[model samples]
Target: MYAIERFESRCKKAIESILKRSVELEVPPPEIGALFALPCHGLSKYPEELAGELASKLESLDIDLVGKIEARGAYVNFFPSGEFYEIVLREILQKGDDYGSGEKKDEVIVIDFSSPNVAKPMSVGHLRSTIIGQSLYNILTFLGYKCIGDNHLGDWGTQFGALLAAFELWGNEEELESDPIRHLFELYVKFHRESEKNERLEELAREKFRLLESGSEREKELWKRFVDLSLREFQRIYDLLGVKFDYVLGESFYYSRAKRLVQRALEQGIAKISKGVVVIPLEEFGLPPLVIQKSDETTLYSTRDLATIEYRLEEFSPSKMIYVVGAEQKLYFKQLFAAARKLGFNCNFVHVDFGLVTIGGEKMSTRRGKVVLLEDLLREAIAKAKQVIEERNPLLQNSDEIAKIVGIGAVIFNDLKGDRIQQVDFDLNRMLNFEGDSCPYVQYAYVRGRSILRTAGVTKVTLESVELLSDYEKKLIELLSFFPRIVKLAAETLKPHYIAQYLLDLAESFNSFYTHCRVIGSPNEATRLAIVSATTHVLKSGLSLLNIRAPEMM
Candidate 1:
């Protein structure tokens, strides 16, 4: 906020002066040099081209400049004077972690994500939402938005009735105590198979379902027991994955509300009788009419979602609601949004859909049992990381700690490095590598920056009578200046991969700067120390945004 006010005042005065002079002198104002890059154009490095081209143009125009614009080949560059350095660096150092955190609007956002069903194991596919949603939460919260994480648990449906029938017939009292989800899984498998052979058992399940809907005391108690038991199992997996939801309200939670919601739709003429089922007449809106209520009177996901939508708006008054679900539900979300709009929802809605998380070109699902547990994948990554740490440095101290920082980081960062739309093949070999575009490599770059700073005994960063810094340092600083802008872009675009890629670029640039410039015992120790500190801060901030840990000692 302070930066905004300060920049506003300065920019206004500068532009006003330029305008006044332009009219007085009857000449156009000189173009401002704003971009920075390394020279790589016309056989020159990006930094050289940036400086030469802009410097020549401005000199020709006879405009007294405050800074130099240079380039190296394809890269354009900028170097501000000592005054600029003092102002920018002091602001960043003063703000610390709050350096880039602009006070964004106090908007409420309902993030419906990772809506895993009860008694279901979290697979690698779930890991996509787990990481994506968590990172999005961090980014939005960092931007000062009030975010509500909603876990729309799949707890109501025909599946529960089948599960109950199976539990009653083949339920073991002891295995439920040891492992409830697995026990339910077994019962569910058996009940599904036996439902075809026995009509009495099937009728009993149907009666129980009816009793559940009709709010019988025994049915309520049974449903509560099943939900509690399932939740007990779900929480363990959620805890392991570091996911916490503000609300874990299930599908059943809105059954009562759904009944009222459908009735209102009927009263409002949004619901119509079609094919003997209550349907929303949306044929004019490029889609067929949707069944709002079935002839049997059982509600669907769309019905519960409509109620959920109305409830969320009433409860949180969110400015935006984003659902991070699988791509297969694209049509479902479209219908929900359309129905909500048709029913007069004024809030902005978004569905963040992502491709499946597959391994070795095969779909991962529970039915096929081809799914990889997130825990198992993480453990394997950690194990491989441990091996890498040992092989790289036999005397590496605190191997377990380093392994974790790198291992878990690899899993998270690997997925984050690409756009969320990109389908990940979940290659273990690629994820665990210490070289070539891996998470550990980026962390190593940070450790290198820290190492350099430590060697220089960097107790303080002082602004010297600065001139045009060399290509590497100036280009690197230009990259550092991109942090705030990139943060804004990431939040606006609803894409964390933007920040991820920017961090990698900064790391790669820092490596080049390190190879070229020596900070410790240098004649220009202050300048180099400033660069090292900036690099370390940027890497730290970037890694933290992705929920990845950075090891100072690595």
Candidate 2:
């Protein structure tokens, strides 16, 4: 356990024990819940009388780890003694990269994210799901939960019928073989355009989809080709983004199961046909009716999603299944979860919805080709980073490699530096600003600390000669003590912003300490160097949790 957590736990126990021993005052224990951790800022929110009462109650008790507790006006503070600092610093230095990780957990969690439709380029819109899901995976895994990343690809449905129809009408084999996604996207756009004028195209598309669903050899082969080529394309982006999934189960993978499920639902009277389309009415649940199958018996995403839930339950029996999807589908997921509950699914379902990414206040659309391709955005960031690097450090070795790390890290940090539900206006300048609350700033802090340690020729750090500490050193240690708690909070809340904001605060704090405390030739050089080393480890570990690389140099 971390020093801060240990302190809080002991404080809670002490407070509870004190309440149990009280006779004259019938003080309820629930009122004292907020009084634990009595740190400098812990009791400021409580009433002065309550603070004093708690202080008087526990001032006599002998707590080993706690140093002193006192109430001042409406604010009460607890000062951790030298023993707490010793334990916190020693644990950080001893554990190194494993400082914040937890014990193993038996429960499994499946995260479904980054599920872009096949044959369409990944846009800025897909960035949130991909990175957010990856960060959650890292955090949950670090906290000892068995996490499964499932990239539930959108490879089946009526849209594919339109794509196939478009391809048969105007697609060139050579163009498709050369630039698969672009050509496929053009074909898709053309289909929507022509269908606006030619109603016959709609029937043609439905027929093509029916054929594909019914297992026509040629249709299946074409669809398989599309899926294969799309996967190769998606892998390139995933490689650049450092994203990997344990399962790449597409909608097609669950089609047969979905069909069987719909049949069972119909026979059991859980679903009914209206206007020749199968649906589960959720009006009683205060949601619109959920369509599981179209009029032509083509399975919809809802059908496949329910089938997916069933498959996960029977296969992994996960304790929780989280979907990292856009907020636009908020209602749809609620309906899906409600339908699943009605069908008696026992697992927990969570929709980790995020706001949309917009360019000039406009949501991206494939049909209009108004979206920025993720590859284009990433490559542009790299180029911008390279330009900045050359200007800053002309003779830096492996500048290209370093640029990739900084560029990609900046983009990711920009997305995660705020609340997940807040809309991000795609801005590369803000993301790449080295002095701002960007990833590069935090990365540079690590690089600066590493440089200090290298100059000191300190391959190993110890807290033995850490006597005569300054206020700055103590403040830095206090901030460092909160890292494990921050990690646990981020994991519990399913919010990476907690860690991001914490890292920013930590980096800022370290910078302040570095400015105030001299390390190279100071009397407390060993102590300050230990502080630098611990800060670098935490910065690196926290960045890894967000799936961003921390370069040794900037």
Best by TM-score: 2
User: Model 2 off-target regions past 4 Å?
Assistant: 20-46
How many clashes in each candidate? 38, 0
TM-score of model 2 vs. true structure: 0.94
lDDT of each structure?
0.72, 0.86
Query: Against the true structure, whose lDDT is highest?
Result: 2
RMSD of each: 6.3, 4.1
Per-candidate TM equals 0.83, 0.94
lDDT of 2 by residue, 202-294 (tens): 999999999999999988898898999999999999998999999999999999999999999999888899999999989889998899999
lDDT of 1 by residue, 1-554 (tens): 43323433343343235334211111111132343222324433554544455445433332222255443344433334445545555556566566677676778999988787665566778878877887888788877889999989888766666666777778897997787767777676566567667877777776666667777886677668767887776676566445678998999999989989889999998888777788887766777677767676777668888889999999999999998887887877777888899999878999887887887998875544566777677878878888988998888899888887888889888888888887888787776777868788889998887777677676556555444467787667656766777787787887889888988888888988888887777776677777777677878887888888788775
